[model samples]
Target: MKKVAILQSNYIPWKGYFDMIAAVDEFILYDDMQYTRRDWRNRNQIKTPQGGQWLTVPVKAKGKFDQSIRQTEIDGDEWRDLHWKALSLNYRRARYFSEVVEFIEPLYQNSYRTISELNRAFIEALCVYLEITTKISNSWDYQLIEGKTERLSNLCQQAGATQYISGPSAKDYIDPNIFSDAGIALTWFNYEGYPEYPQLWGDFSHGVSILDLLFNCGKDSPNYMRFVKK
Candidate 1:
């Protein structure tokens, strides 16, 4: 059965995001929707020795009140250098830091005009680093319909999905009736049962960037995540 998951692109999302991606056959980046302020769309937390800190991508959202994620532009080029420096400082002492630094450093060097593009680039890169083979695409590529749950169901239909899996946070917004009517099975993704890994901070945090798990676990990262080897 073909399973699909649709979610907005997040800046260096947590391990749970990749867990959802790994559980599905196809993953869709739903960025055609309106962009929300202070959301995972443009920023994420990273573990530090002291605590977890947010690394945000400053976007030009001053005049454009109703900007879509695809249309949201980076405020300036300086954020890249600053973010790279922060990551280097925080994760430099991670167990597998040296192994993955080469692959991740280039992402900061390159410039992306939009937040969606930058997020997608990092997501795809991290997926490769974790060996996830799920097909990824942008939502604009599909024929969008109206309504909250309807739009998601339509996207699943467009992708020829027999089952639609989503994060538990959408339980309030998603209507099982919609997916049922579409002959699609709906399942809520669970983020429970994640074991603590060797982390730098005093408290182990699972909500930081996937990079945290990668830097700490290296080639054994997938074993820490829900992704199962075939």
Candidate 2:
């Protein structure tokens, strides 16, 4: 059976996000949805000596509340150098920092106008690093229907998915009956029970960007993650 998962693209998302992608057969970047300010679409946390620090991509969100994630343009290119600098300074001592930086640094150097493009680029690169072979697609590639559950269900049908895998947080609003009605099974992805890897700073944090795991573990990054096999 083909398993599918749909989620908005996130900027260097945490390990759980990649776990969700690895659990599915086809992962859809649902960027057609409206963009929300101060969300994962443009920012994510990174572990630091002091504490968890947020690396936010400055986006032109003022007065454009109705814009979709795919349409959300970055405010300027200035944030790129600053973000790279932060990663370099914080993770320079990480065991595999140099190795991960070889590929990741270029991503920052490249210019991406929209948040969707930026997030997708990072997500896809991380998936490759973790050896996840899930097919990634854009939400706009399929015909979207109205209603929240209806649209998700329709996307599954269009993608020939027999099962739909979703993050546990979506359980609150996702109606299982909608999938049942469409002859698709709904499965909630579990984010619990993640074993802590060699982390920097004081305490262990599971909410930081996947880059933390990559920097510390490099090729063994899959060992700390759930769905991706080592």
Candidate 3:
């Protein structure tokens, strides 16, 4: 039976995002939603003199804009230079810093900036690099059967999935009985087992963005996800 997971598209998210993708048979980028400001979808952290500052990509705001993951814009291409410089300065001493930094530098400069596009492409690139066999698809292509709960379950059934795993956010309020009503077993993903790297500031810090992992660990990142705890 196939396993499926759905998550909001984010900009170059952490190892956990890839972890979920790597662990599942099918992964979907849920981009059919409101575009939030100052959210993970819009910006992320990078090492800065101000102690891990957030670098935001500029976006045009409008009323209830239901922007797809492919449409967002990267407001400041110049910022990419600042980011690359900062990472180089701070992580030059890291074990695999040079290689990882070299590998991602072109991506930072040449790739498109919309959060959705970046994430979708990043996951695709990383998955191939890591040799993951899981198949991925965009949610916009299917007719999601309606009834938030039934919508997901029915869609999974349509895709030949027997199990559905959701983010921990589902643990608090998602109605499990709804899945039962649709004949799909449900579970949740908890982000744990963050790996330790040469954190410039302290012994360990969580949530510095995936760039932090790459700058410090390089190719070791794919295996680091194996440490995730339940």
| C-alpha local distance difference test of each model | 0.91, 0.93, 0.71
- Candidate 3 all-Cα RMSD: 3.0
lDDT, candidate 3, at 30: 76
Task: For candidate 1, write residues 13-72 as lDDT tens digits.
Answer: 999999899999999999998999999999999977778888999999997989899999
Q: Please give each candidate's TM-score.
A: 0.98, 0.98, 0.85
Q: Pull out the clashing pairs in model 1.
A: none
What local lDDT does model 3 show for residue 204?
61
- Leading candidate by lDDT: 2
TM-score for predicted model 1 compared with the true structure:
0.98
Model 1 residue 220 distance off true place after TM-score fit, in angstroms:
0.7
Candidates, ranked, TM-score: 2, 1, 3
- Expressed as tens digits, the lDDT of each residue in 82-139 for candidate 3 is 7667667777777777776555666667656576776677667666655676888877
> Model 2 over residues 81-187: C-alpha lDDT tens digits?
99999999999999999999998999999999999999999999888888889999999999999999999999999999999999888888999999999999999
Rank the candidate models, highest lDDT first. 2, 1, 3
Candidate 2, backbone clash total: 0
RMSD of each: 0.9, 1.0, 3.0
Model 1 spans with C-alpha error above 4 angstroms: none
